[model samples]
Every structure is written in C-alpha cells, then in structure tokens.
Target: MKNASRRQVLQGAIASAIIIGFNPAMRSWVTSASAASEFESLPPLDGILYTDSATRNAAADDFGHLVRRYPSAVLKPGSVEDIVRIVRFARSHKLKVAARGQAHSTYGQPLIEAGIVIDMSSLDTIHTMNAEGAEVDAGVLWSQLLLASLERQLTPPVLTDYIELSVGGTLAVGGIGGRSHRYGVQVDNVLSLQVVTGAGNLETCSRSQNRDLFEAVLAGLGQCGIIVRATVRLIPSAQNSRVFLLFYNDLAALTHDQRWLIAQKRFDYVEGQVVPDASGGWRYMLEAASFYTPPDEPDNSSLLAGLSYTQGTQQIEDKSYFDFANRLAPTVAFLKESGVWFYPHPWLDLFVPATAVDRFVGEIVSDLTLADTGQGPVLLYPVPTDRLRLPLFRVPDEAVVFLFAILRTAPPDASAIAKMLADNRTFFERNRDTGGYRYPIDAVPFSQADWRQHFYPVWGRLVSAKRRYDPDNLLTPSQGIF
Candidate 1:
C-alpha cells in the first residue's frame, strides 16, 4: 500500500512538471519506472531540463567532430543555483554529470553517455570590471571579455590565439598564447574562482583561500569541480601593435632566433610556424609583435638588430590592438565557409624539452607530407618552464620547452581518421620517452594507466581531492582521469 502511494506521488510530480514547461520529449527516459521514480523527487529548477532530440544532438559533438556522446537530458541552467540543485539531484540518483562550455575540446572531454549535461553557456554574464580585472561567468567567451576590456583601454595579459573559446573552458585546460613568454598562461593570471564541487557545494577559492581546490580546479580537466565564475587579471592595453613576419630556411636558425628573442625580451609577442613551401617542402616563419602608443612607436631596426632571419624576406604590418588580438577571426571564417571546419581534427600538441625539440620535430616533419598534415598549420614555439605555475599543467623538466602542435584536419573517411590517430599515438610515445607531456587539448587516446602516468607525483593529491570534493565520482567521467 505504501509503495502504491509513492508511485502516485511520483506520477503526480511528472504530470505537474509537464504542465509547468518540462520538455515533453523527456518521456523517452522517464518511461522507465526506476528513472521516473528518481526524477520525480528532483528539486525545483530555475532552468529547463531539455530532452528534445535537437538539443541532445547539438550537445553530442564538439569542435573536433571526432567523438559524440548524447546525454539523456541537457540542463540549460538559468542560474548558478540551478547547477547546484541539479548536481545534488544527480549525486543522489548516481547520475554522471559534465559541464559543457563552447564544446571546443578536440576529444569528448565534456561528454557523458546517458547522463546530465549542464549547458553552461546559458550563464553568460560579465558581472563586474575595473582597472584590476573582470569577474565573469564561466560561459563568457574570451573574445567577449577582450572587447569589454578594450573599452577601458585594458586587456588580459594572456589570451589564446583563438579568442572564441570560453574563459572557463581555456582556464580548465591552461590557456597558452604567444605572450606566454612574459606573462605565463591564462590560469596563472587568474585571481580567484567560484566553483561548484561534485558534492553540490558552492565554494570560493584562490591562492590564499581553499588553496587546494584552487590549484586542482585550474587545469584540473573538470575532475574535482566545475568553474562557474572567475576573476582574471588585466593590464593596460596599447593603442597599436607592430607585427613582424620573418622567414627562415633552416629549422635550427628559427629555433635559435626564437630562443634569443624570448631571452632578450625583444618582442611583446612571439610565435613560429612551419609553413609548406612552393617547392613542396616546408619552411619556417617567425611572427613577433611589439605593442606601443602613438609617438612611442617600436623601433623596428632595433627590434630586428640581432636576429638571424632571412634579411630580404622580412615583412612588417601595423594593426590596432584589437585587430592584432583577433587576427585569426578571418581565417576561421574562411575555414567554416570552405567546410574544412566540420572535418575531423586530430590535433597533437606536445611540450618537448628544449634539449630534444630540434631532433624530435625534425624527425617528425622530415617524413610529414601534405596529406599527413591535412592542409593545416604546424605551430612550434618556445616557452620558459619557470613561468608555468600550476602543478596540473604539466611540462617537461627543463629551463624551456617548445609547444609543438600539429593541427591536422582529416577527411571524413574512417580510414583516414584511424591513420591520423595511430600516428598521434606513435608521436605521443616518442614524446613521452623524451620526457615531454601532452597539452591535453589534442585527440590522443589515453587509457586509465596512461592517465595515471600523466598525473604522476601529484596523482595521489589529485585522487585525494577527488575523493574529498567529488566523493561519488560523478563529475566529468568522460575525461577518464579518476
């Protein structure tokens, strides 16, 4: 008799929810007696839980177009409180949960099968801004923040090459950029964060408060907690930027000049690329930028004084600060129009120790053909190891490390993708043997043991934090870390 009464209550709640705007398509999942019983007891939400096929399909894949995992339900949270409520409900029901922001990960890092996916983009809000920094919701894109900051002649010290990425998304992965040589990665410049732990607790953390959680959540791969809000450090912006494009015929000359440029602080921004030549081979291009205000223009001759780039091939261009920061926007638009953006991207990003970068990259590129690269840019640049602060943003143990990225775009054919993935694995093993570490934004396949090895020395601390913060192990199961 008691069981029958409870069932009546459950059915009544389901009916009431439907009448109050719950998605009718949810019947597919709620039809199960056990699922209906558990969902009926869910707490009231400010947001709507969507089970419509269209919404589910949109959340199923990401930028890479590599992996897809559809969830049973998607929650577009109207408020941070909705996240807390849904997470608590998921914990009690033993449902896996993942937070999706921009869905830019090359792999299905933010995906969960038959679980709840929190559409964090709904929480877009830039709450406050001043000379010091801006406090923004997790879903706020870096491009949005940059525009807002530029209005006051300020900008974040560090920004990813692609500013369309969400702040929370990049912070979770340790955002890197050309300016990283001086200011470090984006996570290092963060002042504080507001996170939702897996146990349904809302906490404020920083270097001085809840230090452990602060460290873990930054570049934590969404394992311990979900970053909802952040206060990122900003600096005064310059009015103009002078960009120099120098060509190099030899790899050693390019890397040597890059090292010298960073060591001497000769440019405000520094990066390099391996570009395919007209002769069906590859050459190097070193892109460096200098920021300045009017009447204080950069002395081009002085900046290029000691460099060994090909003398006759140097090109100089000037752009507004905003234009310089958003240089990739046009290329991205072209990619989308050409339909290349929809292809599978099996990118491989590694941090090779300075000692081994030349040999490592040389061997790999020597045999790399245009088909192997898939008509994408190969980026190679150096960063000082000491500048990286977070423990989880692992790097090779050396004075400097080079960021080697093969941003490959594979054909839709299954065989082509398999070939690229296999190549990535081989390169990853080679990188690992030389004490290099992956940047995690790539599509390299990793197993449980691989993940454990990736987080060595600090693996125990991460495990402890996972136990303490997300005791049920319900957060971000797609990462396969814990």
Candidate 2:
C-alpha cells in the first residue's frame, strides 16, 4: 500500500511539471530553457525527443505542400511501450498528439500545431508471419511487408498501387488498390489492431472484442486512437502476373468493358484511367492483370475476346508478381528527378455511384483541357460497394461505385492553387448531386458543416465514439471534424 501511494504521488508531480513545460502560454520559457532540461522532467522512455527548429520544420508539412503547422516537439518512440508513455504524458498534460506515418497525407490531416508529433516510422518491426496472416508494427511499409511475406510464399490480400506507403497510414484511410475488387480494401483485410487510446490505454481490439474501437479506428481518421500494430491477412503469392493495357476512344465503351470484366471475375486486377490524346481529346485506358504461372498464361485473343477497345491498341506483358506490384517505383523516381514531385498537389479523390459514373465522368472531363489537369493522372476505376463496411467511410447507395482520382500537381503560386481548388469544388458539388461521397484522403478545405453533411447518418456515432475514446478531443485536430 505504501509503495502504491508513493508511485501515485510521483506520477502527480511529474504530470504537474509536464503541464507547465508544455503550456502554450509558456512558449518563451520553454525556448529559453535547456532542451535537455525541459524534457527531463517528463516520463522516462527509450525513444528520442527532438525540439530543434529543423526537426519541427520537417514535420510541419505533408505531401500537399499547403498547410504548415508547427509542432512543439517531434518524438520517435523506440517501442510500443515508449508510445504508451508519451501518450500518457500528453493526456495528463492536456497536450494534443498526432501520429505521423510517412506524412503521405495530401491534406493537413496528420499535422498537429502547437502539440507533439509522434513519428511512427521508428517502430518498423515485423513480428511474425504464418499461413493465416502476418503481425507487424504499424509503421512497416506495405512494400516491406510484401517482401517479408513473399519469403514465406504468402502476400497480403489487398495492397495499394504504391506499396511504399505505411501500413497504418493506408489502413487509417481505407487503403484501396487494383486487387480490391477480388479482396476488399486493406482495412477489410485486417484481423486486429493494437491501439494507444487517448486515455493512454494500450488495448488490442478486433471484430470479436472491443468491436466499437475496432470499427472506429479502421477508418476513424485518427480521432479515437493511434494504431501501433496490426494483424494483416495474407494469401498465397502468385508466381507471375500478365498485364494487358487496352485503349478506347469512347467513355461509355470503356466503362462497359470494365463492368463486364469485374462482374465476370475475368481478371485478377482491374483499373482504368483517362489521359490526354494526341488529337486534342481525352482517351480512356483500361488496365487488367491476370495472375498465373508461365505455363498458364492467357493469350491476348482469349483475354481480349469481347472488350469494347480499338483493335491493335493493346500492349501485353508478362511480369513477375513482385515486379508488377512495384511497377510505379520508376514513375515516382522520374517525378522526383523532374522537380515536379514536391509541388502543390491539390489532389481530389471521389467515390461516385455506378449508375451516375457515366454522367460524372462525361461532365468533368469534357469541361477541362489538358493544361487544367496539368501532368498528373486522371485515375478512374470501379469498386464494389459491399466490399467496404465502415460507417465513417461514406459510400453511395448502389451495387457498385467508381473511384475517380484527380492527382494534380500545381505550381506553388496562390492563383494556381485557387484554380485547382475551384475545379475540385465544382467536381465535389457535382458528386454531391449524384449521391457520391468524398474519399477524404486528398486536399479539400471543408467546413464543419460540410463534414456533417458528408457524414450525415454516422455523425452521431462518430461524436459518441470520440467522446468515449478521446473525450478531451486531443487527437488529430487538423482533420477539423470536431
């Protein structure tokens, strides 16, 4: 009894010291104090804490290059225990905390101003793997996990097009990829998650236990808890994949073929995009992949039997499964070398109902010129509605839905940003009229009212969950939902 009482007293004293050191009003005092001394009074852990200008500046912005919110300190937790200690310290001191996993977010969704930013990348450890699934640290990238799984002749069921993204980052935002039609989104493939709640409780939740937290944290937008680790479902890895690129001049024809292919399960992977044509018009490109061994490779005639694509406008290639998944790595390298990779990416991702996809595409693409879209990609693909079951991830009421992504790279000028924002708004309004939902992964400045309207039926559940998990509302303030 005496020892417990002593521990309580010590914890109280430490909490009081942290409150004073982290107080926003005492900014000057903190700056003047020795960086070492300022943090010495807080909890002791194995992680590294950086309060320097350079470290803070690096954590200020994300892929969007729009919002730059300075954090008070950047933390690289050495282990899961270190994360728990840091979150507990922040909870006791009333300091907001946000997790940064590669900072791939195009919006300021992961940025936390005047608070602590927990860098999750330091905890990249793959714990174990088996025939059923793999258990890995949240900071592990999909690419890393894929390689590890491949060694065991297994691979994750769903992977984003860019495998370089962190596992927790993609799961938090409902990771979707070319194979999502067969499996589901990455979140749908998760078996369990280890989360550090706002109250500093390190809890493991799954569908059968702590069900609410599991659902909320899947696409919860980091409002409830920070996912420290996850159990990802895996399947047998294919030896090779055959890729076919089909081109079409008419939008309806392309979509018709996509619908037919997906419904028939004729392809292991399916996706399509719109690009500028040499004749000053837009062209649709349908990409499909079939997994097989060299002996079982499908011929072009059989694969392209009845698609509505122009003859002789097809490119077929046989690539190893690993090579096919990592195909976009070269494109990213070129973008970086060309100096446009770091530009303002006012990207927009939308989910339109299958019934309304035709009208939405025709209207948006017909009104824009090649210059307006810049050199980015106009990604359009179809995904089934029933695959996703998260309430917070709003979707249209249809059997099928289309993911329309306008990944635009804009100049750093204010006027250019304004024009992109206007175009996004125009498309957003059109999507709203057609019963579509904003994917919320890209850059779009939305008000609280707009968010409420976007999440009409689930708004109450979200608020209640936030109250139960993060009662102080101290997590992910940049989302601006609360």
Candidate 3:
C-alpha cells in the first residue's frame, strides 16, 4: 500500500512539473485560442479545445512507427458543423487544414505545421443501407462496417491492406488491396459522399448529383473538401475464399504470371509482395484468394512447374472473405503497438502499363536487385484495368502495377534498414533515366516540373480540378503542387 501510494504521488508530481514547465507558453496558446473563440461562439466548446503543452505535443505524431514528426494543430471537431466551421475559420485565418484520419501514414503526409488538422475520429456514425447506398460517417472504421455487412451477408467489394485503417482514412488516399485487382479501387466503389466544400457548403455529391464535386473528391487526398460522410457501393460477401501463397525466385517471372492472371481474369483476387531472402535480398510473394480452386489437383509436380517458384507448398487456407481481407490486422496492430510506425517511410507507388512493365522491371531489378525494407511485405500488385480503361484518371496507360518499398528503421546494427533507404534513393535517381514516375513519393528529390511531366496529359485535368476546387491552395500546403 505504501509503495503504490508513493508511485501515485510521483506520477502526480511529474504531471504537475510538466504543466509548470510549460505554464508560460501554455498561457499564450490558451490566450490565442480564447481570443479566436471570442470573435464568435464556436459550438458548445464544452468538449475541451486542447491547445496547451499536451495538446500542442499531439501535433507532431503519427502511426508510421518510425518517421520524423512534423508539427501541426490537432483539432478534434466534435460535430459536422464543427468541421465546416473550422475549415472556414482556417481559410479566414490563412491557416491550411489537413483532414487527419487515424494518422496511419508512414510518410509526412499527415504532418503540416502552422496549420489546422481536422481529426475525423469524432465524426463516427454508421448510417443504414438505402437507395443511394450505405451512409457511413467518414470517421467510422472499416472493421465495424465489415461486421455489420457480414450479418446481412453483404460486404463492400473493396478494402485496404489492413482493415484497422479508417474507411475514409484509406479512401482519402487510394485504398489498394488484393481484391482491387478484381473489383476496383476503394474510391471506385464509392457511390456518393457528403462533403464540406472549401466554400463551407455541406453538399451530398455523386455521379448523378454535384458531378464535378464528386469527381474532384475521389482520390482527392482531403484537398477540395472535408468528407464528413460517404455512401459506398455494396456486394454480397463470399462464404469462403481459397487463399494460396505461392513463392517465386524471379521478380520478372512472378510479375509475368500475375500480369497474365490479372489480364485474363483467371482469379478473383491477385496480388504479390517481395520478401527478403536468406541474405536479406527480396523474393516474390505471389498470393491469390479465389472463390474456387485451380483446376489442377494438389500434386507436388504440378506445383513444381510454377514459374521460377519453389518455396511454398501447395497450401490452401479456406477463410471467409472478411477474414481474408483483414488478415494483416494482427500484424498491423503489433507494428503500431511496438512503436515501429515512427520511422520514415518512403513508399514509391507507380501505375505502369502492361507493355512498359517488362522493361520497367527489367531495368529496375537488373540495376539494383531487391531493396531491403525491414518492414512489412514489399507489395507488387496488378490493379484492375476496367475502371480506368478510359482516360478518366491520369496515370501510365495499360494495367496498373502498384509498387511499394517501405524503409523501416531498426537498431543500429541492422544493415537491412540502411540498404532499403540507399536502394530507394538509387531507384528514385535511376527512375528519371528509366522513365519511372514516383507519384506519392514526390517529396524525396523529384521537383514539381518532373511531377507535371510524370502526370503527362492528365496534368491539365489535375491542375484544372485544383483550380476549380481550391484556387487559393489553402488545403494540404505540403503537396506543393498548387
């Protein structure tokens, strides 16, 4: 009892010391916020508008488990009106606003200093399934929705690499998963969204309604408006998925098989990742989750004939579709809980056409083999072509190949982390010579000029959209494009 009491007293003393240490600076922050509040009544203001030492501390944080922190204001808007009101305030105050969803980003995308961060967690409400589609508040987690959908034997066609990420979180960026190869991207599955535009107007937009606003918001990256709610398309959930993990020695061989499978629609789900070899080199993780099995029986010779692959057995794991999609939840949670999300993540995702892929991979793999990112699987997946078969989105022509290389920080003795960063740097530099365009990995060394050229013909449409929606470029100041 005495020891427990002593510990409690020590904790209290530490807390009080922290508050005392920042008392002077805390006064200025509170005074500024109070002055801002004085100009007009902003909501109830009862839920606690934090801006002191602790609140200010929350600004420079994320879920990457390993990136350097960038300072930004953390605003927990209690209501939808709060979001609209805050965006307007930020616009008037000449401060940028970034919609922060769970802060799961490994890169500095969520970190914006001297700006307002509109936290979406408070906007949690899952609306019912109606004519338009199911109305889910932007902050709702996908795991919650998956359960509700499964009860009715219905599910959203698309999902993320991990289900713990917020629905709007992944959708804010482009949510890609194994199923994306078949159904389409998470953005493509959305039927409608309730967006709070830059003008502070609450609008419900879809293909049929507010068409321009709808188009801009998809893959919009929280620039045009605050997506307070979304209505996504739904499909019946498959009872079981026959998931198979095939191993391949050669990246080219694995990609070749994957490209063919995706082109011919041979499987319901198709995706691949590269795992480090015994010497820490990377190998292919060719995986698929199909509703049916391959026609060939589970024989050793049949499996041996796989393209340059021999590691994996003809193992088949049967799981419900929902379970399969969220297979990485435990691993994701482990990474987050273990403080691995704090490292700098340089993920280079590119959309390569089928024709260019051969030369693209051939040039890349030959020059620098597999990079040694000491993080999760190095994803190399083929995205569905039907959605963007036309000139709707601006990216490389042909089937989209989503490529990513994560650089995870480790203890000083680990060589894999350093090698990963070095290889990524080399890859980015050589990419200019090889005609590879790294989109989201823009901040590293690529200039805006290269970004424009990379976007090619779609540059006009993108800039036009930005001009139409956010002419002043008040949102996402870090993007630097506007």
Poorest stretch of ten by lDDT in candidate 3 = 18-27
| Count of clashes, each model | 0, 0, 13
For model 2, the local distance difference test gives 0.84
Cα lDDT of model 3 by residue, 1-482, tens digit? 21124454345335322111112233222233234322433333212233434554565666543343443345566567776766675565555777777777655566677666776776667878743357898888888788787777777787776677677776666676677777777778888888887766788988899877777777666667778899887787666677778877776788778877777766678887766668755566778767532342233343334445565444667776777877887776787698665444544555555556656655654444433344545567777566542223344444455544443444434355455545555666555454444535222434578657755776776677667776657776554555
Q: lDDT (0-100) at residue 110 of candidate 3?
A: 63
Per-residue lDDT for 468 in model 2? 92
In angstroms, how far off is 32's CA in candidate 1?
A: 14
Error of 3 at 330 (Å): 2.5
Model 2 lDDT per residue over 314-348, tens place = 89998989999999999999989998889988888
User: How much lDDT does each candidate structure score?
Assistant: 0.88, 0.84, 0.62
Question: What's the best-to-worst order under TM-score?
Answer: 1, 2, 3
The CA lDDT at 384 in model 2 is 82
